[model samples]
Target: MLPNQSFVWTGATPGVRYRFAILADAGNFLPDQCSTRWGSTDFGSRGLPGSPGFSGVPTRNNANGINVSWNDYNASYGVQHWRLYRSASAANRCSDTHIATLPRSTRSFLDSSAAFNTDYYYTFIASDLNGVNGPCSSNSAAGFRPGQAPTVSAISVSPATVVAAGTTVNLGVSATGAIPSNTVAYQWRAAGQVVGGSSPSYSFVGQGNHGTKQYDVLVSHPESAFSVTRSQNITVCRADQIVSNNACVCPGTLQEIGGQCACPPPLVRVDNQCLAPTPTPTATPLPNSFPQIINQPQSQSVQEGQSVTFGVVAAGNPVPNYQWFRDNLNPVGGNDPQYSFVAALSDNGARFKVRVSNSVGSVDSNEVILTVQSAPRPLRPVLECVMANNDGTLTAFFGYENQNIAAVTIPAGTNSGGDANLVNGGSILPGTQQPIDFSPGRVRGAFGVVFSAQGSAAYTLGYRGTGIVTETANSQSTPCAPIEPRLACVNPEGAGFRARFTYSNQNAFNVIIPSGPNNRFSPAPEYRDQPINFLAALGQSDHFEVVSSSGGDLTWILANLSATASGNSTPCSLPPVCNAGGPYRVQQGQNQVTLNASGSFDPEGLPLIYAWSTTCPGASIAGTLSPLATLNLVGNRQTCAVNLA
Candidate 1:
């Protein structure tokens, strides 16, 4: 039969037994070639009972296995019994085993044979008195019994003990005992505020007031909903301050004399202070004298793209002329004591000095080095959209644009240690769902964090390097564009290897990248069957694969961002499939429509089960448990949407 067409069987008598079968090939339907293996067999003509629905959330308990409950099948169809099938792999439903056969009234089952830390799928089916089984439940319920919770062995900080202010410190935690296949998430917090991302190592710059700061890293995994925290104390002192008597204190010359910062010789203490010795009188100055250099320029360190300046003070007769020199040879500044310019990467480790001269003589200032560190590319956080919930709360969907060719991790925090912070009324809120590890390029609606405030409350997002970006929880924002190429999955294909790549375009219009520097693969023959045109906001691509030799890594370059994949790269984990076709509309007087979700598929070639639900009032759904369902509206002018899972 053609797609969406049904076969009809006519003329059935009461109390008469009937059977039907469908054969794939004509040879299988021939009298001499008939075989049950060719297609279906042993189906009864009498209608089967409605499929039972899973009632409550399935729970897995240690040693006792998984417990599952479901609603009873329709009794009017003359129920016989219920069968529970279990499968270890969602992609292989044909391998499911009949684990239990229960009485007609039974609605619960305990599968004691399940293994811990492993996901299992379960479905229930009913059999009629005629001995024919009804359809299995539309969707399978998954259950996983978690193993041991994660443990933190120790937390370590580099610099070992103390760090100078304006210095970067590295903190890391060693953790173990998480579920075998689950990834552990890390959150580093300082003084109870999250300061790091989901990485085991955290980079913290010691800024602001100097003191002993407390930091903790929380390690967790979703498998068990369990977490453990380990903490470390870091001591920091400012540039002008010294660690004396276990405390940060200013030098005695600046005032405080206790705590090991004693005054030097020739300075006598009087009235809780150190007084400099009296100055001796000197002779009168000559008409022409050598220039005396003072206030020599200090060394400077700054990130790339930042500005730096060097200045020298001098005392001389006839007002000494000044000139600045770079690297002791090249004249780089005008005839002024101050030299200032924007720093570049090439200026790192270069030295600067000033020559003060008059008619009599010239004095050169001490040379100082300028250290220029390469700054990380800035990541711009974009607030894509806001959603108002039925419960009066608001949810803000956020995404980001990473200018780097590689991924960037921005920790969670407020005004420190992170790439961005979300603040409401001066109080920082933890962005639990915000993506800390940002993939390169633009990603729209990556994650959302909720807000409880209502009615036009503006939330501010403070991103490092980018000033405060404010948006109301109810504001509508435009989405950003095109995605970076990524290595989706890799698998061994015969003698060679196959690597799949994918990209996302958040723009409403398609984007095209002509194969060249912007879109090409590395190591020659740049166009490796990759697509040049990308669909707009279509989630992920159906995906394109590249076959390569068994050895080297194959990299896909798109818009200057590159992603490499090899045979050894991690395989992709496909998520469950749910595709409800159409924003289907009907005329004002039309009350019924059919919804189809037959186009949904699993990338790993898994069998899919569909469950339909709707949120319209006074409406009833028929075939609610199947991939194809019908929605009937009870009144005119009613609007609704159906969801498939």
Candidate 2:
């Protein structure tokens, strides 16, 4: 049977340990002989209570003392009161003094004994009804009380002397010994009347007449009966006078010389007043002369879209009038000294001169030239041929043709966007060879890649203008053949017909055939402006023209290649505008020179591509991807033949 019983152990030692034991069914047993101990010290012993949690120590300084506040201590143990401790130093809590004992509901206390400008640290501890003290608060609060009186140490007035009527004079008082919690008051009085509020400074405006005024500031604290008074005297002078040694005197610029206002030496007195000296007279004008050119217009080279100006400076009797001429014929500019226009392909080689004239004789400036270059073009990839290897693998020969007048750079690798890459199927070929820098025109066999016999090669290339183009080649492609000659067409020239011829050289290098049995034009003198040096690629042409009044055909033979041009042949289209920059000259030892084709532009505003070719052996060209290409010259006298497409 289960029984519910109550047992009480009364008058136990406060805050002492104890335990209870019960015997289940023994004949006789002591508490120590029981198998289990019900109330051991580990369960918990009765004590005062856990320390109260502090919500934070906040203090306020008042006239009487400092008020300290905290959160009320709430616990299961019955609290009879709270003990408040105060210490002068926070580091030494052992030296803290028992300041006050408050009731259980009191969470704040005022320390009336707090001295002014002295710091006091305070903490709280709760006490149970049995008079047992709990642990002290985890944190201590600091408080301060200010002094009773505000001390005024000094008084000042800015601009001790007022130079003019209606000028403001500032009077200020400085004080100390009053804390932020104490309301320090200020009273500014003039002739026993209040003029300003509680601010420490007062502004006094001088009006009507010149006189000396007194201003006083009384600094005091609301809780103190004592107050401090400081006075400052301000002198208000007229507009024409300033205070000196507590008295008005003449202004600085006009000193009182012999009892009258007088100007200093070098300034004469006019009509009983001081005045400044007269200004010097202007020089006479010189006689007029003929117009003479001072600064001449300089020659400039710029891009097609850019603007160019030619200016001339001249000196003459009357201001000179200006007139500009292009190529010494047509008048292009107005009466201004400068002539400005947008550069175009047609203006590449034109010369500009300005004539400055007035009532005097006119003078002409030296002619200056303007060179405008064309924009850069995109690079194109061309798969020249695929050669079969003896090892059962195929070697694919690849090359690129830059149609621009400048070089084009397509870096090698698939990661290089808009660059050159040789790929098999859809993947880039391993260890493929390709040129990062592609010169202008047809460059045959510039690079090669070896692939398995069953594999086909695809070439991907791009630039700013061409976007991207991919070409595939395999063993079935045509074998390599270097050069071929063809007649473009025959066109009517005045009363006669002209025969035009062109050639395509696929080789990586130029092929030259002199006028002989290997290269000749039938029926007459073979050298009719036909280029002996056949440049590599399709566009490099020795485009020669021969006129026939009798209406006959012309045949050109180069090695085994031959073509005939007749009146019945297809007519050639009109040529596009192009500017090759210059027939530039350099010193014999010069190592480098720059070529520009910025003057070339399309009439439709379409972007123009640059392709530059030179006949100078041993010379290399850099910066072929831009309008400004650098030619690295060999220190030789050989003439360089440059061509632009």
Candidate 3:
């Protein structure tokens, strides 16, 4: 192909040779001098040959020689790299022959190396590392162009079937057909009810009254048709109460007694219904005293030194005033609900009478005999105690702590007269300790006191002076030991109490003493802080009892005595003490304020006793005094308010 007139192989390869030629015109005309041979001496030197020929390398070199060569087309099965070549015409076409080597990674190449808009033939052949070329591959035509459309796919709804009355359902739509994002929209409907627009899914509450309770969802996209509507049925109904058996009471209406609407007992029918018994008149045996007084037909026998408490029951209009009498005199001072004889003796005759009075009339209780005999004096007497003395007789009838004689199961304190003493234990005051015996006291008149002392002289003492057994003062030679006294004082407001004290006469000379100490008081009894002490000088060997001047004042009582002087022997008047009424007060309609100087007996503070006396009839006793006690009145209004005494 190098303008040579003869066939000559340039490179060495067995069984392989190449020839070059060009078809000037397709199956037709050939140009003049198209078959001219170079280096053949056929056309004389330097003269123009009638045809183009191969030149330079193998045969004689010549100008104006064009040659075209066609190598055996090599078909490469797996080769990715290929080169393309094309020729224009015969001998001089060697100069026009061009080769374009595809990139090593390229599998195809276009013949742009040739002139544009011209029919340039191309062949693709593979090259190997050994420089051995393979046969040319079949030629394929191509031109630059643009790309294709996208795809869309998966579409779904979460909780496809949901219960009615739920808010919203989520539709998860997925697609991969084409332009999925821009193409998708959703439409939803329930039964035949259409929801506007489109989403993956839609939810709606069932219109129970309007239509069938069902829903469906439709998903759509731009690329393709919308998906079929997904549907679900939800059950919905109004809430209703079901009654099965005997006429169930109409919702909240009250049913008749024995008609599936019976109420608890002691409760009477009210308002065409049964309700808790409203506050009503519960007669408390007229006297309003508990542990109902069991009247004895005649006198009862009591051993000496055994205190007996007696109660008498009498009923009348406007409540009765009671006076427990011994020898026609009121025993134990006031004629209140309770009467106590600390210790009995032979002198106590068998006759005791209680007189009751009311607004309408008065009645004399049957003479109850209490015959006293000589016996060992008890350590203490029966003391009926309450935390805050206020009237609770009627109101607390059903309360656990109410004074119900039948329910008074346990005696508070032990009494030698009531039971056998264990280990010769001494008597105890009421409210101080529990009685050891299981047998409850008769409670007809008195509740037994517990015995708590261990010593032989251990004694239960109640200050009630009407006891048959008389109090004997120790001889002057024997020198009775001093006892801390209880005092009562009157305050401008009500009653107060003071604790008794005997001043220490340590200096052996008359010296003025300023009470004892400034004991700070605690309103709440839980935290008992240390008593505040004050300086008060006292003379030695002086016998003076502390006295409270004011009425109804609370004062500290001496718990223990420690005098500076040795064997300080002095006897003073005993401290006077009083018991408080109950804590709650019964009023006509308004709240009440109860004042008590009970337990205000402090000799060093005040001597007089202060007690609250009210116009209310139900006012009972509280065992101690306080700063003030108030009761909020309840129940129906009353014109004639009962006085509390």
Candidate 4:
């Protein structure tokens, strides 16, 4: 007994409760064989009715008899066999009777075939393969009923809500209170209008009307009327519309007023509020005079280093002060009527604004953009070999200019010079490629190129031409005359000094003594800083050196000179030899010589004298000299041009 078990002595649906017990001494108080009645009748105090039970207390179809069927109570329990019996007492006191016993699941057990209108009581026992006997469990009182009807529950629609032009919708119907083993048919209706039958769900492919469309479903069993209809509705066009919901468009002359059109100006309306006419352009009480903004430089674009000027003409109660701004914020230079800027690339897209201020007010003119661009760089010249020289050499030149010219190299077959090798850092001619000398015998004659420079560097491309050679003339050099030496510059005693030496004289002439920046000179050497000057002095037995005014401090070595043309009897006409009437003289005429000894000062400040002599015995002369010495010379005609002694 799972707790709360109650036993009732039931007969023909009478309500009562009872428990069977043995007599005090009968079978040792065992309850196996005795029966009793209990319930609202309080049968526990009355005990069992009689030792022998009454025969057929109630019969089937009689007012006191009751019939049982699972289908009448909407039960799904199937029966394979059943047994019926009757007695004058309760469950423990009844005599068992064998009724119809059949196999397999069954739903209907008819008691109508026997005893009509008579009180023939019946007890039903149903069992399946599992031996589950019917009335295995019953209510406190017997339950009876007519067959149930199929009841439909709430209906449902897939995509429950849709637009006015309703798309396909699936309808479904379900029922809970329905007869078991009975087929239920469904009928669908729209807005009380019969639409279709025999389906649990239906689809409405389109919206039936603009308003809410309602669908109802009715479920029915073959033996009963349809219980009830379940319904659901879907409303179409649920969106709010301007025309239907307080909205209007403004006409050309009228304005929208609370969703209605109305006249504006003169009866001016703003923000949905109407007002009196706006005063007719009341002579704006502006200052008597307005500051005039003048145009400086209106519109122009310039490269870096270019100047830009801006100004404005203004008329106002007070002459306005002008201040310029760049990019609408940064203050640029100004307070005057004009402003200028040296344009730079960073200044590109710069906007210039002028703020004009006076007692009345200040106003800024519309911004003007200053466009800055970069200057166009020079192009590298194209150099090509127009023709080859008689020596089968390709001589060309190019005028690529810059602050300085760095390394120059001609590549591979383009400049193998017939030895299949490259030559670098040679002379370059104007407006032509560098000369590449080659003998007329080798093959693989295409020219390749690769080069770099200091700034905005670039290289030249090589092109091949006719493989044949033609006799051509090489460039000729013009004999340059010796140039006269002008005192180029003077330095005020610095360790490392520089002076630009100029030679305006066209003919090349050798300095007979140490003159400027003179390095080592022994065997009468010569140094020329420039090509034209160096080539002009070629093969001349001459030496040039820079001598310090300080004794023994000249930057030269007399013994280091190895001139091949020494002792060739060339006159040293630029120096002391000429002034003393020695063997070196141009015209054998008197000339003055000055010696600057400023750099060779003595701390003792000793008295120094100028002594002049020549190879000629009678040419001696002497005089007290300043720290710097000067001398006058006299000519000697005899004794091998009168040697000075």
The number of the candidate with the highest TM-score is 2
Supply the TM-score for candidate 4: 0.20
* C-alpha lDDT of residue 151 in model 1: 76
- How far does residue 271 in candidate 3 sit from its true spot (Å)? 20
Tens digit per residue, CA lDDT, model 1, 1-645: 543566766554321245654444455566543324323444445656457578876675553568888887444456678888888866644247889999878888877777677788888777766666777774456786756566777888786557667878888887676653357888989888888889999987886474677889888876666788888888888665765665666655555444333455788655445688778889887687789986889999998899898998888888899988999999987888889999998999999989999998888889999999866666666666544433444445566677665776655555564346443421222322545677878976555555653443343444456455555554343323445676767777666577778776665544445465556777643226888666664445557878786546888877535789877886657675678998888886788889887667555334567888888878888997776899888865556778888
Off by over 4 Å in 4: 1-301, 304-374, 384-396, 401-645
> TM-score of predicted model 2?
0.34
Model 1 scores a C-alpha lDDT of: 0.69
Scored against the true structure, residue 193 in model 4 reaches a CA lDDT of 86
Candidate 2 RMSD to the real structure: 21.8
Q: Per-residue lDDT for 43 in model 3?
A: 24
Distance from true position, residue 419, model 3, in Å? 93
lDDT score for residue 480 of model 3: 14
lDDT by residue (tens digit), candidate 2, 294-400: 99899999987789888887899888889999999999878999988898777888899998898868989999988878755666677777645434665566777
lDDT of 3 by residue, 394-431 (tens): 00000012121122222333333342222123332222
Candidate 1: misplaced stretches above 4 Å? 1-84, 87-144, 243-278, 285-645
Cα deviation at 32, candidate 4, in Å, is 98
